[model samples]
Target: MLDVLVVGGGYVGLSAAVAIMQAAPHLAIEVIEAAPEEAWKKDPRASAIIAAATKMLDVFGLWDRIEPDAQPITRMIVTDSKTSDPVRPVFLTFDGAVEDGRPFAHMIPNVSMVAALRDACAERGITIHHGLRATGFRDTGPSAELTLSDGRVMASRLVVACDGVRSKLRDLAGIKTVTWQYGQSGIVTTVEHERPHEGVAEEHFLPAGPFAILPLKGNRSSLVWTERTEDADRLVASDDLLFEAELERRFGHKLGTIRATPDRRAFPLGLTLARAFIAPRLALAGDAAHGIHPISGQGLNLGFKDVAALAETVVEADRLGLDIGSVNVLERYQIWRRFDTFRMGVTTDVLNRLFSNDVTPIRVLRDFGLGVVDRIPGLKNYFIREAAGSSGQNRPRLLGGQSI
Candidate 1:
């Protein structure tokens, strides 16, 4: 039996495998992905890698391969309404660096992130079964037996689920998740720009939702335009030129003319949180455990946190010759991560609700709160430090820039 069998080969799963292998190179590890080989080939969307998450990648030696292609965010500006709002002007502005003198976040293409993780796993001799799908599983004496879609059986001491929001493994394990669809959808696309973003990110809170312009490699920017579901469907179905026109209208001329990338897509928004993080010999991580609206851009960052905490807890337990899959060991991870996850989930949900409407009272109150936080240097610094990700337990060797 292998030491660990990881379900889902997304960012979180690979990160977990890397951590386990780094901690004990001889530990047998296998990752199963339902997609055919090269399933993530050329995924066009871009993702934000917060400083804390990048540091974890650095520990795993995966950041060096991805850093060259990443776009740093040197500053962030949040606006109450339009770019030219007259009252409650700039809701908030933050320098990109959180603490330890580093940029707060970096933006990289989804495919590039996947490529880096895949390369790292291959370099370490971690077997990734991409084409094989997980069908069912049963709990054996000291292991979990996983059945594949093609009639193959694999056994491991533990099964870690890092699948997406709709996790099949989580379902087979009977782990319930609370989920609700936001009446909104986010339209994401990249654009070539005339002026340099100067590593500055901007979020314009429109009545529909948040319109984020995140800096990207070279003179490009990634756009996350939120809208009501019905309106978003119509907008995405329109002709490219028509869509571009609407985009330009919402996205002001501060950056000169805007040109859309050839591809664009929209996804329905939602919030999902699992009822429990551990069950018997099973553990949950990444989107399987929690999913939140992207308005705050904290989705993947939270997943990285889960990877670090879970990996550290399991490694520590293994080092002590304890059962890594025991309820006690897994609950340690849950205890460390649940509060942080719940806080972020609540924050994003509240932000999404407060900003997705045109109510004058909320608009005024939120804008005022932003101003208050901005004016209080101590409070602002705390917020900034927290955003940079330095205040947490089970921090990995890489999170602090130490080699694992």
Candidate 2:
């Protein structure tokens, strides 16, 4: 029997496996991925990794490998306007530096981050089985048994599900969730610009939704353009010329001529929060636990936070000779993360509802709120630290750059 069995071999699952194995090598850990091998290479997405997550990666010895491909967000600008408006007046500006002159976040290609994580798993001798899915999950007091698509059953003292929001394992384990669709989809794509962005990230709140332009390496930027689901699909399926024209309407000429790459895709936005984070020998992580909007860019960071908290809980329990998967042991992780996850989910949902509209009174209220926050140095600093993931109390060891 393995010590830990991870379902869904994405970044979160792989990170969970690596975190535990590195701290407690005597424990056996393995990952099962539904996708075929090398499928992760085709992903054209990028994520904003906060400073705390980078510290955790640094502890894993993968940050040095990932940093070269990352573009630091030296500053962030927030604006509110309509798509037809010729100008978008900036409402809030944030200097990205947090503590010790470290930028609050960096825009990193998904490929680069996952590549380094996979390399770390290889060095740690962690076996990752691809092209396999978990069909069923059973907890038999002593261990959890997961049935794979090939009819093979694997038993482990603990089972961690890092599957996405629509996790089969979560259903099989009988975990319920609070979920609601926003009727919006985020259109993601990469764009090459004529002028440099100078490491500035911008979020423009238009009538449809918030459109973000995140700086990337060289003269490129990654865009997260949110719109109604139907409209997003139409835009994605539109011709290059038409799409670029529409993109330009929102993107403006700040970065000069912009050409979007062809690999654009749209993802439906929603909030999914598992009511329970653990059940017997099974624990949920990543999207299995919570999936929030991209308005704050904290989706992946929340998953990384889970990795850190879950790893510490399991490692410490093992060091004390306790059953790592017992409800008592896993409950620590739940207590540590559940409230924070709920708070963020509510925050994003409220923000999305508050800004994704054209109500004049509401717009005036929100913009005034933003302006107030911007003018207060102490409040702005507090928010920056919060976004950087370094302001919370009782943070996990890895997030603090310490070994478990």
Candidate 3:
């Protein structure tokens, strides 16, 4: 029987496989993905991997492969209202860096990270089954039996679901989720500009929502512009003239002519936090466990955090000769991550509700709070570090530059 069977091949599932192998080299691991391998061929909407996450990836031996294509964020320009207001106002701006020159984060394309993960997992002899969607799952005392969409069965000591927000395995295992739609849709697209962004990531918080412009390599920037779902769909389907014109207004003239790249997409925003992270011999990681607004760009990192913690917990349990799939073992994983996940979830939720509005008195107070946080150097570093995944209980392998 296999030691662990991960039901998904996205960032979360692959990361878990890698981390487990590093944490306990003898543990047999496999990943089953529903979609065909690398079939989703498009420029990904991008994910902001914080410094600590980058460290974990470095441990997985992926940093070098992905570095050349990434853009380090050296500065963050956060404005309260308008992107076009030059001298009109400046609520708060964060010059990004750790210590002296170490970058706090890197803007990496989603597809590139997945490619790195897939290749690395393959190199480590992990069985990544693409085109095999999970239909359901059942815990058979000592092991879990996974049922795939194509009438196949895989029995393992532990079953992990990283199959996204609408996870079938999570549902099959009877795990409940607390979820709600944000009404706003994040319209993600890349843009090319005439001038270099100088590694500056800018976020302009409007009444509609935030228009975030994060720098990619060279003259490219990734946009996560929030709008109503209906509006976002129209924008996504609109002509170049209509889309670019609206983009220009919201994007402003900071980086010169901002032409949207061909890869245009929109996803409705929502918050999905699983009620119970584990059940019997089953565990949920990534979107299957919890999902939050992308305003903080913590979605991927949060999933990585779950992967790192759970892998370490399982490995330690194995060393103790305990059943890694036991409810007690899974509960330990839940305990370690629950608070951190809840804390970050609440922060993002409140921030989204606070900024995704135009309440006059509240806006002034929020802007004031922003400037206050920006001015305090020590506090700013703390918040920055927290956002970077350095604030929680991380694994030794993740921290000590070991492969995981």
Best by lDDT: 2
Off by over 4 Å in 3: 82-88, 393-404
Query: Which one is best on TM-score?
Result: 2
- Model 1 regions lying over 4 Å from their true place: 82-88, 393-397
Indicate the TM-score of model 2.
0.99
Better of 2 and 3 by lDDT: 2
Deviation of model 3 at 151, angstroms: 0.4
lDDT of 3 at 97: 79
Which scores higher on TM-score, 1 or 2? 2
lDDT of 1: 0.86
Better model by TM-score: candidate 2 vs candidate 3:
2
- TM per candidate comes to 0.96, 0.99, 0.96
- In candidate 2, residue 73 scores what lDDT? 100
lDDT tens digits by residue: candidate 2, 228-308: 999999999999999999999999998899999999999999999999999999999999999999999999999999999
Clashing pairs in 2: none
